[model samples]
Target: MKIVIIGAGAMGSLFGGRLAQAGEEVWLLDVWEEHVAAIRAHGLTLVDTAAETSIRLNATTQADAVGQADLVIIFVKAYATQAAARTAAGLLGPATTVLTLQNGLGNAETLAKVLGAERVAVGTTAMGATLLGPGRIKCGGHGPTHIGSFSGGATPRLHDIATIFTRAGIPTVVDNNANALVWGKLIINVGINAITALTGIPNGQVMANAETRELVRLAVAEAEAVARASGISLPAADYFDQVAAVAQATRDNRSSMLQDVTHRRRTEIDAINGAIVAAGQRLGIPTPVNETLTLLVKTLEKTYLV
Candidate 1:
């Protein structure tokens, strides 16, 4: 199957490089001219805990290069989702599947509005990847990827994709309730990512600090209420345990939010915490903690941008 991966940063390059190395026809599309040029010249590099390898694949900066594909995996930032979807419209066929493995909520919904709901799938990846340089990614953590249809429909293609990842040594699972899984990840991110970003600390530090741990619990509790009000079943009591588990797994790793903050780039705070606040408003639930976090991040973003 022909596959196209939008945004060749970290996660996108890791997955695209693996698929290409596995002898699949994969194309990496990005707007970054320098990165695309580097990939086109020297191939994409994948640096993981196991080994560092490079795979030659078609990389382009033009969206028109995103021709018809059986699957299109979008890895753009949350704020750039619409633009990426619109550019990737050329890659859509009648049976094409568009899957988004983005963080937080509403990404699937946004893609569904651009592409049809029947053609859209949502997923969350626990795979940790950091951009080492142009056309290079350092993969750190190991975890399973979960994917499924967001419209509550069963698709055999999801299983096919999961099998492909499994063959490439990336564990994957297909679930009927991907939205719930996404919400679960959102709960964890709400608790962990922002705290790390604000404190400039790793997961271990946040979990080890008594005051920060309580603050994380408060944030997760608020996010849990928002999720429950929106008809999502997320038990708050077990949610903290899940957060602690992530802390243990990636103890020394900085979260994507913290990385973004350090790089002076915008964080996914809108799609993460801001999503909870929006959902709370729609469901008549209060999300003061999430609101406060979102506002603070936005304020910080403005300061850095200026």
Candidate 2:
């Protein structure tokens, strides 16, 4: 498959490297010039727990350079989805599939605005990554990845993509309700990301304190309420338990938001928690905890490395 990965950061590089190693024709397009240059010069370095490997693939800072692709996997921040789509439009063939492993809600809608819903797919991944340097990322927790059509159904194309991921060693599944899948991932991000970024703690450390755990719960509850209010059914019945389980499973990992803060890079706060706050406002669902967390993360972003 001719694949182009937008926003080749940690997760992007992780997937791109794996697919490239699996002998797929993969190109990584990102604004990270240094990373792109490093990958172009030395290949992408994927550091597993006890093993290290590199995959040579095409990479460029300009999306137009990639020509056309059979699939476009979006791994960018939610805030950059539309811009990435716009930049990537030149790379989309008539039958190209666009899927997002991005966190947060409304990514499908944003992508649909650019490429139309017929070409868009929504997805979430449990796979985690830590960027050590340009062209280098440590593969953290490996988890299931789910992809589905934006219209809440699966097509043969969706199953084909899932099979590709599974063959590359990343377990994947085709789901029906894309919104529910996005929200299921969003619920976990909403509860964990902002708090960890604020407190400078890992996922396990964040859940170790009772007060913080409740705070996570409250934030997730508000998000859950907003999801139900929007008439979206989430993946889990005891959603808070699912959040706690994620915290446990990926305990040692710092979330993407926390990684952004530590690196003094801009975060997807507006996309994750802030997206929840916007939905709550539109739906009249009170979300003080999420609102406060959003503000706190944004404030920290302003003050970081100043």
Candidate 3:
């Protein structure tokens, strides 16, 4: 399959490199010129728990250079979904499938607006990666990736994409409820992301600390209430325990939000916690904890962005 990864950041590079190694034709599209140049010149280096290997693939800063692809994976930041969708047009043919393994609730919707709804898919992944430098990334760990049609039903196309991903060594599953899958990942992000960014703590330490753990519990409770109000079924009956277990499993890792803060890049505060706050307001549910965390993270952004 001819694949184009939009973003080419940590996760994007890791997936693109793996697909390339699997002998699929892969191209990475990004706005980072130096990173593109580095990949074009030296290939993409992927470091995993097992070993480090470099895989050669096509990469460019321009979308037109990639032409149409069998699959387009949207891995850009949540705030850049619309922009990614705009660029993705060049990568889409009549039969192309656009899958967003992106974090947050509304990314698939944003893409569906620009691309046709029938062409979009929504899902989440547990795979973790860190950008080491231009053309290089460390795969922190691997986990299952779930995908579904944007319209909330599984299709043959969904299964086909899952097959392609699994063949490339990325475990994938097809889900019928897109909203539930997105919300399931959103719930975990809400409980962990903002608090860790605020405290400068790793996932395990954030849950291990008493005050932070309570904050996680309250924020997660509010998000769960909002999810219920929105008529979305959560992945787990006990979300707090689910979140705690995830924290313990990925304990040593710094969250994406924390990584963004430490690197002085903007975090996805608006998408994760802010999405819950917006839903809560529309549904008439109180989400003070999420709202507060949203404000604090935005405030934290201001401190560095200026």
- Residue-pair clashes per prediction, in order, are 0, 0, 0
lDDT of each: 0.85, 0.88, 0.89
TM-scores for candidates 1 onward, in order:
0.94, 0.96, 0.96
Ranking by lDDT: 3, 2, 1
User: How well is each residue in 1-306 modelled by candidate 3, as lDDT tens digits?
Assistant: 899999998889989988998899999999999999999999999886778898999999989788999899999999999999999987789899999988887898899999999999998887777788899888765678899998878899889888888999999999988889999999999999999899988888867878998998999999999999888887789789978977876776778898899899998999999999999999999999999999999999999897
Candidate 2 lDDT tens digits, 61-120: 987678989999998888888898897688888899998889887788988998988999
Task: Please give, for residues 77-145, the per-residue lDDT of candidate 1 as tens digits.
Answer: 999999978976789888999999988788888899989888899988777777877888877567778
lDDT of 2 at 214: 91
Cα-based lDDT at residue 241, candidate 1? 84
Worst 10 residues of 1 by lDDT: 228-237
Which residue runs of candidate 3 sit more than 4 Å off their true CA positions? none
RMSD of 1: 1.8
